[model samples]
Target chain A: MDRKELEAKIIELVAISYGKDEGEVTLETSFKNDLQGASVQMVALVSEIENELDAMIALQDASVCETVKDLVDAVEAEM
Target chain B: MNILDELFAKAKEDPQKVAFPEATNEKMMQAAYETGRDGYIVPVLVGDGPALKALAEERGYDPAVFTIVDVADEQYRDEVIAKYVALPDTRLKEKALARRMQDPLYYAMVMQKVGEADVTFAGIDNTTGDVLLAGQMIIGLKPGISTISSIGLCDIPGWNGSEGTLLAVGDSAVCTNPNAEQLASIAISACDTVHELLGWEPRCAMVCYSTLGSGAGELIDKVTEALKIANELRPDLAIDGEFQLDAAIVPAVAAKKVKRESKVAGRANVVIWPDLNVGNVAVKLIQQFGHADAYGPMLQGFNSIVCDCSRGAPVSEIKGNVVISAVRAAGQKK
Candidate 1:
């Protein structure tokens, strides 16, 4: 997937996991600070992303992905 | 059988009813379901009912199987507030009481206090301090007990210390820098845990760097004084110490270091550390390096049974903790 497509997908997963609107999640939206996503939810989000994209995202890498853009970049790197 | 198996059996026998305030988490809900299905507990999920139901369905569990109590309901909120206000020795202001009525932790405690539930198991999403505070404020302490303490039940393989490889380490996850009196209370609480949960005769050791006054310092003095207080509190229990860890556990070390012919010296299953620094570090070392399966830091000294789980705990660990709490509740009833 292209970078824009990957970023959109990441925002969608974060939005769904945190029960937020897709329009509310942006590239700079932090999983924890902005969305109030907990560690368990973050794990679930990563799993969902990996499953949807069929890409391997290491938990360590996912943990450091603070924002939606970071998560997209990590997913792009894995792809 | 291991300690978990023993507790599971006891839980099945009487099936203590339990409440979980933080039931929104999928892991906790799953464990609650499993424990309920296995006849270990009648699990009551205290939270927003619809949200919990949605989460349960999302996690592939049938919400009908669980008793989800909505704290936000008007009737439930009023009932909890009335119970909280009517509780003896409750010093919470009306504002605080109203706020607490909205908190699921306080609601769970209210359920336990009013015989609506047998025990409360929380701390999956909350901190240990939060759980303890809710427990202390709502449930109150046991009679004559002033301090709240914790005990970690360590199952060390090939180590025949207390009732096989099972041992209890106290004040590890609570009581930061307890005085002699608080330390004594911790020991007594740990002994009660061993007796209640494990069904074992507690042989307690007031562990320190010294082996019966072998070392000289304020720390050794603290352990010695705590041991005296513990003995005075429970004369029947086999309690002794101010011993080193080896002297407390290993018979050979006790023989060489401890001259007294005390029953607890060499065969202590419950070892009370001097402080949190020692107790927490020692338990973690045993868990990581010694490869011991540590079950708790199970909060003790409360009138009702309430346990706190690590935020990162897995479903299996939560299930084990629930069983342990159930055993405690069953014992308290007796």
Candidate 2:
């Protein structure tokens, strides 16, 4: 998938996982500050992204992700 | 004897001295009284002897029946504290042990740690956190247990899979989100718990939203990895999955969904949820909708039997939990 598609899928997954609006999720949206992505939500977001992207994103790599863009960047790096 | 009838019988057969530190509370007092009166346990109330006895009288319970361990007795207190501090693997020093012993909960646990009491039961007047903290600092965890978790017995009315209406589910009351290794430890602990407490040779299933290789995710990976780790750590156990609820318990569903020859899939007597979200919710659904009688959220992985009953639990529930604890402690004797 392209960069834009990857970002959109991640945004959708985050929105679904956190029960936020799709519009609320953005590239700049902070996972720790805004999303409060604790272990449960983080695992879920990474899991959904892995399913959508058809790629493996190690939780160790995903743990450092600060925002949606960071997650996308990690997935792209994996690809 | 599967639905705690066996434990109740075992407890009566070899009744243990169980300490109730929060005995001043009527529910705790009543549970202690009833469990003792019924011969499930010899309930020891740890607090001011006079106050407990007076409260027992006020509640129309016979005060003399309970062995009230007076924490204020400096002579007795010092002797017990010294013994506790001197035991192998004791975390606390003499001064710290003595100071913490002033608290009734600590006093009761110390009594157990030193072999005076078989089990320490509380949490009606205390929080789960309180009981757990005291248990960790005072009683300590079992040797192989890396994380402390809980196991509960669910006696579903109509669901008779392996153990005839009784199923064990765990980590619901503790561990918010356990990883693969912690999940493995929880599974192993659950196996030991059911075997020790209920006398069931446990068949454990690491539960998830998937069944075997049917789905994929980090969540599914966690459960599968947990089974791998558990198997590696203790090959004697029958732990399997990444099974969905039905595949874990229902034989027909297991035959359909899981093509592999899984020892645990079709007949899982114990179900270990991936995390607290699943464990906590599944248990409520089982109790409320399935109309199952859920016995515990009882803290396991302790060196001895240390129970933390929900504060909102009724007298009958408290009595049952105490008996469960007593029975578990009895298993330790063997």
Candidate 3:
């Protein structure tokens, strides 16, 4: 719904996708560099985020958002 | 039983568990279902769960009949990532693991590497280069084997020879212009595969434009040197060459052209071409003009069982290749 909530949800999805603890995922944690998410995983992660937030997030736009905070910002902008 | 029948019988005895990373394709799904149903293999489909289930349902096949490994799920993702991290020479760490986990092929390879599955089959959705790269990077290479090659199992209608008359063309889909050493490795790998698949001791001929020293060129020299290297490396194998195609396969021609005695002369089942250009052209010519039944371009020399099928391969060919891969896996365990 909001920036904090979206960021938390994004972080949670990342953590779940990677099987990492929620505490390990941070705002600056990059999906590729930090989470080691491949292209398909990134798509899955973005899809999960969009479904949870019930918003239309462009895959192209989401793909460019490298970090969790960037994804949160993208979601907030769309909202 | 025929060669394929025997292979299927052997595979069905203890069907090797096979993982398909690109199981969403309709042909691939059909092949997987048929092979599993026929007891040739136990198919493990790796991909998104809902998508795979939906595809199976659309195809009138029950998804519950298949062992589906959903890489997107947390449990399967974590397990595959952990197995990958533990692999020898794995570059995938925590960050990279996330992305690699999303790849069905990578997950299938990890399953093979960890002994969860006996073999992995893909390349319908990916290229041969991609499948081989995943195999080499994840499943790793066989011990002391530096090169991974491909062998096209050719079955010519009227060409009669030993061991069901199956001929193998090497480096058909893998190496480009291998040096002498690499050529020797390809020859050896081809011999090993022919032996495993056809249950016959392979008489390998390193084919060239020249028969022995009759012709002169850098290519001929490479083939001759490859023969010498192969002999030194594997003295027990019946390998000889730098022979013309006729001298390699036709006994009458061998008797005329080959002045010296050789085991593989005129009776060779395994023919190693000088380069990919020749190998590719030769196999295709045989398949098209000669109306030969060509089975593979099967990937060889990997430690684990990984096979590549042609893009848009039919269901029957896919099932046959799976049996071939399973037979190889069974032989390797022995």
Best by lDDT: 2
Question: What lDDT does the true structure give each of the candidates?
Answer: 0.82, 0.84, 0.80
Sorting all predicted structures by DockQ, with the top scorer first, yields: 3, 2, 1
lDDT of 2 by residue, B84-114 (tens): 8689966566665676678999899998999
Residue-wise C-alpha lDDT for candidate 1, range A1-23, written one tens digit per residue: 77778888888888876778999
Candidate 2 chain B lDDT trough over 10 residues, lowest sum: B90-99
The regions of model 2 sitting more than 4 angstroms off are: A1-79, B1-6
Query: What TM-score does chain B get in every candidate?
Result: 0.92, 0.95, 0.91
lDDT of 3 at B14: 76
Among all windows of 10 consecutive residues in model 3 chain B, the one with the lowest summed lDDT is B89-98
What is the C-alpha lDDT profile of model 3 across B190-298, one tens digit per residue?
8888777766788999998999789998989999898888899889999998899999989999999999989999898888999999988998899898788887878
DockQ of each candidate relative to the true complex: 0.01, 0.02, 0.03
- Candidate 1 residue spans exceeding 4 A from truth: A1-79, B80-84, B93-95
lDDT of 1 by residue, B129-247 (tens): 67876776677776656588899988888777646787889888878888887888888888888788877888989998888767899999998898888888889888898889999
